[model samples]
Target: MGFKPSNKSLLLEEILDALGQLTESLSWEIGTTNLDNQTEFRALELLWWLDTSNYWTTLYDTINIGTSYSQETIQHFFWDLTHLISRYLGLEISHYTAHPEKVAEVFWPILTNHSEPIEIRTSALNMLMMSQPTVSRFLTLYWFMQAEPSQQMYNFYYTTINSMANSKYPCYDKYRKIAAQIVRFVQHKWHHWSTGNYLLDYEEPMRGYGGIVQAILMANQRTGFPSVLRLTLVRQVV
Candidate 1:
């Protein structure tokens, strides 16, 4: 009378379906839904089990349901599930010392997938960037820079580069190269705004420029590329 692996897999699938149904039955509001604490706890419990049991591949498949499900319920459930998983990863990533690379492998697609909600993507990005291992953080930043750029990509790039500039992350030399590439990309995208006039048309343009300038100066210090910042300043002065 032993509990078989097949039985365990079936039970896991049933649990997931039950959770999905519970999510569907709830109101389809993003922030305004009155979800119970018990539901969140149950989801977290399941995530913990999946991680500890080496079922992360299964969990990855579940989260990446893709855009095929036209039902609003399924879409919202997956979004909520992704957010919960990101939280769980942030809190429990240290426990994954033996398989940090695996964690990255599972979540990188979710982070880079434009179809995913920005909040979910941001959560995944933050979790990976803040993981205890420097390699995970570095790889996360590297992979993100290589991904297709979006309007929000500038903010992410600036934030990551700024953080690396200010921290003693032990990989500054490597990050310096990445930061240089980011500066070039940002410059190319927003070069039209160099005069600071076009930036005035957007909300919080000063804050955005301030971040870019900070990143430029930091990059200058590391790579002796003061001309980039000087060129930016010159453009502003002209």
Candidate 2:
């Protein structure tokens, strides 16, 4: 080698070059002069490599807070990188179940925040529901129940609850407990109606009442059932 740069100098140079390259790479615009489609593809290639390589820690570290990047830059790259990683892995939101901490740190925020894409949020919630003890699934239902109702989310939570309550995996006793929890939780969260009305509001308050009643009925249809849940029908008095 006639003249080679030192490893230290090369590494420093590479870090700065990566920052600039990644920034341009994230955008969709492709210029014919300096940057083209090839440039953008190359940037993604670099990101894929770094994500799989040993230097990923260094790569994320370089972009996260307290680094040389500006707050705006850090936030932009952080979200873009997160979305990129999530997409790379088959949109498998349940993958985070292995890292439960990530459910709160990552998926929960996306699921609860209305600003995120609906598909992404729904997928995240669906995966979360898949990884459960009936209690955890109930909690997930509680969280989504608290959100402004969307038909899709409403249906998803209902279907998930029904499946869990009806499934034989939880045993009769455990299943009863889950159904009781659902009834109690639904009643407490939505106690604005009479004891025997069964109307579907089609709007917010009584929207999911049918599902809750169904759960209660299913729960009581068992041997040795304990005390019945006395929740009122959330129908509007006409």
Q: Which number leads on TM-score?
A: 1
Clashes of each: 0, 0
TM-scores, each model vs. reference: 0.42, 0.40
- How well is each residue in 128-220 modelled by candidate 1, as lDDT tens digits? 554433644665466555654653434444454545444333323465554444444443242211111111111234553221221222122
Tens digits of per-residue lDDT, candidate 2, 1-238, equal 1123346545445545656665555442232334533333333334443332334344445554223444334434444444344345432333334445433444555667776544445545554554433576557557657664554444445554545545433223364457546754442323211111121222244553222221221111123232222232333221
CA lDDT of each prediction against the hidden true structure: 0.44, 0.42
Tell me how candidate 2 scores on lDDT: 0.42
lDDT of 1: 0.44
- Weakest lDDT window of 10 consecutive positions for candidate 2: 192-201
Query: Which structure among the candidates has the greatest lDDT?
Result: 1
